[model samples]
Target: MGSLAFFIASLGFLLPLVSNANPLDKRAAALKPFNLRVTFKPAAYAVPSTIQHVQDAVACGASNGVTVTAKSGGHSYGSHGLGGEDGHLIIDMRNFSNVTVDQTAQTANIGPGGRLGNVATALYNQGKQAISHGTCPGVGVGGLTLHGGYGLSSRGRGLTLDNVLEATVVLANSTVVTASTTQNPDLFWALRGAGAAFGVVTNFKFKTFTAPENNIVFQYFFSPSSASQLATALTALQDFTRNSQPPELNMRLFLSSFTTFSGVYYGSRSDFDKIMNPLLSKMGIGSGTVSTNSWLNTLTSFSNGPLAQTGTYDTHETFFSKSLMPEYMSPEAITALSNYWNANARSNSRQWYLLFDCHGGNGSAITKVSADSTSYAHRNATFKMQFYDRVASGNYDPSWMPFLNGWVKSITDAMPSVNFGMYINYADTSLTKDEAHTHYWKDNYKKLVDVKMQYDPKRVFEGPQIVGS
Candidate 1:
């Protein structure tokens, strides 16, 4: 305790330190997360504005025998950013929210705290450049790129992680190092896919690409009465995606009030029509809307409002989400999922939606990236499906976990032959560590474990489901 206090006093810069001993109000504010499903109180929360402060925070944790977790956006579904369990030291990186672009170099150096919306706006406004990323404006760049940054643009352009060129990281041993393909290559590989378990990356250097000139958004809705009807529609879409999906087109199927299919095209309207018209006809659907807009406008249309999260409360949700990256969705499994949805979707009082985002097809950039280059598994996935459910009001009930889990199980059970791996970003906290090993990273789990042994052998960056921990 004396050492911790002395260390805090010795710091030259202004650092916001919130300890568990602090009043509930202050501690609550510090520990607040984007997902309200799980709650864990950290022993200390340090908001570091500079790299020195980050290093000092890591040093303090190492000296005190306290596990350290870095929180960028605090958007982890399982609250892993808050140490997943509790009694750890949290290094919050919200102050590191700057995005700088090197126009001549054709790259962008992004802070760990930069949000998707803000990053997009800055990248485009400054350089007319962009990186493929998720649509959520509030998702932190650190978590998104570290895991898998899947979005409408990801199919055409690669994932946000794919664009990563380098990073400045604070290791668990309290040493700072630069990681990239040339320097600390092993750390760089682990950082790209399973970063949270390895170190706290203060900044990222990403190779940028020219923003598309013609950004077209399309939407198609269908009203299927029976499970078979839903199955037919999904099967048609899946068959089409497996064989003919274009790199310029990114799309998803959403099960909501209306069964809808929507996405963005990076090309002209005529080109989009030529490709989509055939799919629509095959699905036995005729009418859908297509609108072309500027890149910024298209991004804003996907967001709820402004891309940056700016408010007293950092915008949260009471929900649970699970994801699956499947090489193929068998017709039997599709029918089973449709049956489950038809039987229970409307009966439940909670707000929910199932989304199937296309990740693999004829010439997907996502699959083009070699799976062995980075620790990110499921590179050959045909589609990434996310099942999300949130409470209508108030906090989520713990008992509802099984209900959501069951929804995912229905599909996986039906397709016993397939290995539907889970996405680490949309983490399911319910799984045991052993189950997580197989579901999150299939063939790469062993390699991740070896990397963890090398960089953080003692597991300073510990969490419930963190790789190797």
Candidate 2:
């Protein structure tokens, strides 16, 4: 969901299976693997239609000393669903892709395999309701919700995890259990944000909200001729986010060939223009595009629809992405980022760009909740920064990677006072283990570890940077 770009890569060798059925059976091949760019092939892949099948896969993996990795949409940036290495069994949950809505209860039961697009469409058809999810429709609800889903409606509606009322999970021991506010409360709290390490979530029961009838999307492309202009624009953006914060307004900044300011206002176009006028005028944006559309259409516009179905889905291309949750946008940080972009403008791949997502505000329900109430700890963050780049030929270029790494380090080092943290969903394998734990979990790391020990003391669900690993 960070940035949709296709990649071509080779697959790893498959290991023999213990099942009586042939490993190459039609069912096995029919199991859809979403991230083709990930070469971390498991010893076997199973499309489990029922809980029994999931249990059997776990049993097989346990008996053979191979770990079991649950692959829902397979959209994990770090390929956490693909074992993150090799010699594991993959439990593909595509068969479990189902969405059931209870109109009276104002709730929806979504399977882990269900993508955001399908979930949105299903809920919309049910009663014109919706949930907060990422921009990319192909991203699995399991992964997205488990790691704190951010989207166009997040600031107003809260995260996807915040909407989850309950979850059905298959623990490391292959036992099924339900976690919720009153049932397995500790696990419920842990699963909301740091779930990947404890168990495989099979289904999520979410509290739904009435979908907004129309959303106004505004797009502005600025060609700043000087650093002074860029700095002013950045300062205006910061001011707008901090002072004129509107719950309905979701703003994003992109730095590439040109500086682009995009925003989605969950209201009428006239109201959006009224709220954004001061920022627009201050930034000297004479003209821009504003269109009103349905919530589902807005999601499609953001992600380009289902990536798996689209030929543009880069199955072979691999990419590396890193994220930072900056407390606020500082002028020095802005200048440092601009300089980095200018220096690497021509050298970096066209697909590569920087993303700054406006996050917290007074109206934001995200900040209303206590940071310790859920596994997600970045409630005070004003914005999130992402540095994304595509890997050439499924591999990192030695010379280029070092430079890129140093550039990232410089950006973080430049802002020592900023409460910098990282989003686990936008995972970066290049980080050291300690760095990953500190950035991703923060103060929640110890509690998550304790829960991991309780559910999986033997560490069955394991991966790089996974809790208790």
lDDT of 2 by residue, 1-469 (tens): 0110010001211212333456556333333233344457566666667786676666556656667678777788778878777766777776677888898888999998887787788888898888988888778888899988988888898889999999998887888999998989989999988888878888899999888867898788877666567667777877777666788998798866666888789877778868888888787666678888877777776876452332222333456678887667567777876566656653566466678888875767777678888898788777767777665455555355555565576667678765478998888778787888889888898999888889888777777777776
Candidate 2 Cα errors over 4 Å, as ranges: 1-38, 306-316, 346-349, 391-398, 417-419
> Which one wins on lDDT?
1
Q: In model 2, where is the ten-residue run with the lowest total lDDT?
A: 1-10
Among these predictions, the greatest TM-score belongs to 1
Model 1 lDDT tens row, 85-124: 9787888888788889998888999998988888998899
Candidate 1 Cα lDDT to native:
0.84
